[model samples]
Target: MAEPAGGPPRAGLVSVVIPARNAEATIAVQLDALYRQTYPGPWEAVVVDNGSSDGTRAVLRSWQRRMPQLRPVSAPEASGANHARNIGCRLASGELVLCCDADDIVAPGWMAAMVETLRTSPAAGGALERRSLNGTVALAARPPKESDSLLDTFGFLPYPAGANCGFHKELWRRLGGFDESYRYGSDDVEFFWRAQLAGYELGFSPHAVVHYRLRDGPLAIARQLYCYGRSHPRLYRDFRAYGMPRSRIGEAVRAWWRLLVHAGDLAATPERRSAWLAGLALRAGRVAGSVRHRRPYL
Candidate 1:
C-alpha cells in the first residue's frame, strides 16, 4: 500500500449502496447515521427501492435537502434485496461499493474503517452488534454470540453478512454481482463463497461496526429463522460439490429430542418459550427445505 506524503492511504469515491423495501420506519435512522459519518473521503449513498408500497419513497424525497449526496432510485421490477442491490451497484459511479441494510445503523467511522481495510483486501465484512438496537426479549430469543472475524457456514469457507460488507467495483463486475435466485436468505453467504472460489480473499474489519436489528416477538423470530433454515439446504446443495460438509444426523436427532422433552413445559419462562418456538420453526423449515431442494440437511 502506498500513501502520499503524510496523508492517509489513497482512496477513491465510495458509493454506499443500500437496498430498501418498505423501510419507511427505520431508513431515516440509518440515513441520519450515514450523514454523521467521519470518513474524509468522497462518498454517496444510492438507495434502491424494491417496490415499496408505503411512505418509503416519500421519506427519501423528504431527505433530499438534508442529504445532498443521497440518490434515491427505483428497482421495483424485482422483488428482493439482491435484485435491488444489483441495480444500485450498476448505477453507482464509484470505484468502491459498500453495502449495508436500510434498517441497520453504521458506526461513525465505518466507512473510513472499511476503506482502510479494503486497501489491502479485495473484500471485507464489518462486525455486527445487536445490543444497541434490540431489547431483552429479542436478544433472549436470539442470544448474541461473539462474532468471529470470518463467519463459518456448514464447514465451508467463511463469509460475511450482506448487512455490512464492501468490495471494489471491479470485483463486483467480475463476479456478476449477487445471485437473485437466493431471494430470501444466504445471498451474502453464496456471493462471498463464490468470490472466494473465484480466487478473491475475503477479509473482516472489527472497527467497522453496524448496529444490527433483530426480529422481535416469537412469531417474527420463528418466521425469520424458518426462512434462514430453508436457505441452508439450498446453500448445501449448491456448494456440496466443492467440499461443503453435510449436517450431522446425531446432532439433528439430539436437537429434536430436546425440543420434544420440553414440549409440554408450560411453566417455562417467556424467554425460554421464545427459544423453543425458534428451534421448532427452524427445524421444520430445514425439513421443508430438504424436501423442496432435494438435499437432506436435517
Candidate 2:
C-alpha cells in the first residue's frame, strides 16, 4: 500500500494521539518530548482530555503556545481510554496515526523511526525503555530487538506497548477503531490481533524509543495486573474468532501453578512481593473472567 497522500510530502503528517486522565504532572513532559522530536515531516499532537479533574487541560493549553502543532480535544464521557484515543484520532489530519500515553517520554528521533517503519511495514511499535518514578529502568517488559505480532501479546518475547505503537489511519478505520467496551485493558491487544488477522504485519523499531513510567508500588502493580487478567476471557474469545480452540484449560492450569510457586518464594521485597501478588491476581482474574465470558479461557 502506498503512503496515504496528505498535504505534507515525504511521509505525510504523523498524528500522535495522547489520552489524558488526571495526568497533570506528566502530560507536559510528554508534550515537551514531542516538541523535541526531530521528525521533519508534517506532524501533529492531539491530546484527548479524558475527563481529567486535574490541571491537565490548562497544561495542554499552555503547551499549545509552545507547540503549535499540538491540538487539544475532549472525550468527556468518562468512557474508556480507547474512546478518548479514537476521538483524538478522528480529529487528526494525518494518514499515519500514533498513540502514546500521557505519561511517557519519547526519545529523540522516535517519531521519524516509527513513521518510517509504518511507511515501509504494516504496523509498527517503537521500542520502550521502562522506568520507575525514580528513573530506574525496569528489568522486564523491555522492547524486543525484532518486530512482533498480536500472537506475541502473551507468552512471547515481543509485543507492542500501546504507549509506543502506530499504524496507518486507513487501517484504523478498517478495524472500526478499538473495542470501546474494553474499559479495563487489552483493547490494544484486540486491535493488534484483529489487524494481524486482517494480514497486516506488526513491526518493531529499536531506534524509536519511549521511556515509560512503571506503576509506582505493589498495590498499583497488582491492580494493573488484575485488570489485565480480567481482560483475558474476552481476549481469548476474540482469538477464537480467528481459529483458536475453545479450551485453554491446560495452558491456564500450568500458568496458575507457576504463579503459585512464584508467590510462595521466600524473598519478600516490595517489588518481588508485588510481582508475586500480581501473578496471583492475574490468575484469579483470568479465572473469573473466563467464568464470566462462558469460555474456559483459564
Candidate 3:
C-alpha cells in the first residue's frame, strides 16, 4: 500500500526547476509527469527559458493555465543551462528544490521519494542515491541509462542525475547555486562536489526515477561529448583541491585501447557501433580540451 500524505514528505514544499533551451519539442511531456506526482503537498515547477527563439515560451505559457503552480521565467541574456537554473531557483518559493530537465520524463512518486530522503536523513544536507528516504546508496544503479545496477557510482559519472536530484533551497543559496559561467556540461558535477565538501550528506531513492534522454546520433553525440569534454577542465580547476581525481589525463589512450579491443565486437550491432563512435568522439574532444586548457584532463 502507498504511504499516505503523512509518509516521507515531512520536508517542506518542493520546487521543481527546469532549464530549457529551444526545447519546444518535448517540454510538455516533462510538465505532464510533474503534474501527476502523487505527493499531496505544496509544490511548484519553475521553468526558465534561456534565450529560446522558438515557440518554447508559448508552450510554457499555455501550460501555466493548466498548472497554475508552474511558474515561467526567462533568461534572455543567459548563456548556459546553469544560468537558467540559478534564475529559476531564485524565483522559487519552496524550501526544497528539485532540478529537473526539460526533456526527461520523471516517474510517479519520484518527488515523494526525494523528499523522504532529505526529511529522514541523519544530516541537514545530503543526496539521495536511488528512490527511498532511508535507502542504501551503496547499492544504487548508475545514472539513468548508463548501466543497470552498477553497485557503486564511485567510478562512473554517477552523482545523481542533476535532472532528477533535489535539495534544500538554503543549501542551494549557500552554495550559490550552479556555476553559470559554464557553456557546456559538468556544472552539476561541480556543484555536487562543492556541496559534498561543504558537509552535505547524500541519500538514495530507489524509486525516484527519471527517464533521461541519451545523445545518440553521430553529430549529436559528438557535440554533446565536445561540450562535456570542454567543460570538464573547469570542474577540475574548481574542485581538484577537494579531491576530484586526475584520471581524465589518460582518457584518450584508454579510449583508444578500448576501441582496439572492442572494434570487431562493437561492429556486430548498429546500436553498439553508434555508441562506440560517440565514445571515440568524446575521447577526441577530451584530448583536444586538455591541450586547449593546458590541463591534464584527457
lDDT by residue for model 2 over 1-298, one digit each (tens)?
A: 0112234312477899898898899998888889999988889888888888889988987888899888888778767888887787777788899888998798899998898888787678876665434322122222223332322555422347678899888888888988789888787787777887888888877788887777666567667777888897887776776665554577778877886677654266654666566667777888788888877666
State TM-scores per candidate. Answer: 0.94, 0.86, 0.81
The segments of candidate 3 whose C-alpha lies over 4 angstroms from its true place after superposition are 1-11, 121-158, 248-252, 260-269
- After superposition, the stretches of candidate 1 with alpha carbons farther than 4 Å from their true spots are 1-11, 265-267
Best by TM-score: 1
**Candidate lDDT values, in order:** 0.87, 0.75, 0.68
Q: Ten-residue segment with the worst summed lDDT in candidate 1?
A: 1-10
What lDDT tens digits, residue by residue, belong to model 3 across residues 43-121?
9888888888888988988998899888888778867878888888887877778887897778888888778876854
Residue pairs clashing in model 2 are none
Model 3: which ten-residue window has the lowest total lDDT? 133-142
Candidate 2 lDDT (Cα, whole model)?
Answer: 0.75
TM-score quality measure for candidate 2: 0.86
Candidate 1 residue lDDT tens string, 1-298:
0111212212588989999999999999999999999998889888988999989999998997799888898778879889988888887877788999999999889999998999999999989988989877678778887875877857879888899999988898899988999987888999999999999998899999999998868789889889889998999999999988999999999999999999864357777778888888889889989999999999
Q: By TM-score, is 1 or 3 better?
A: 1
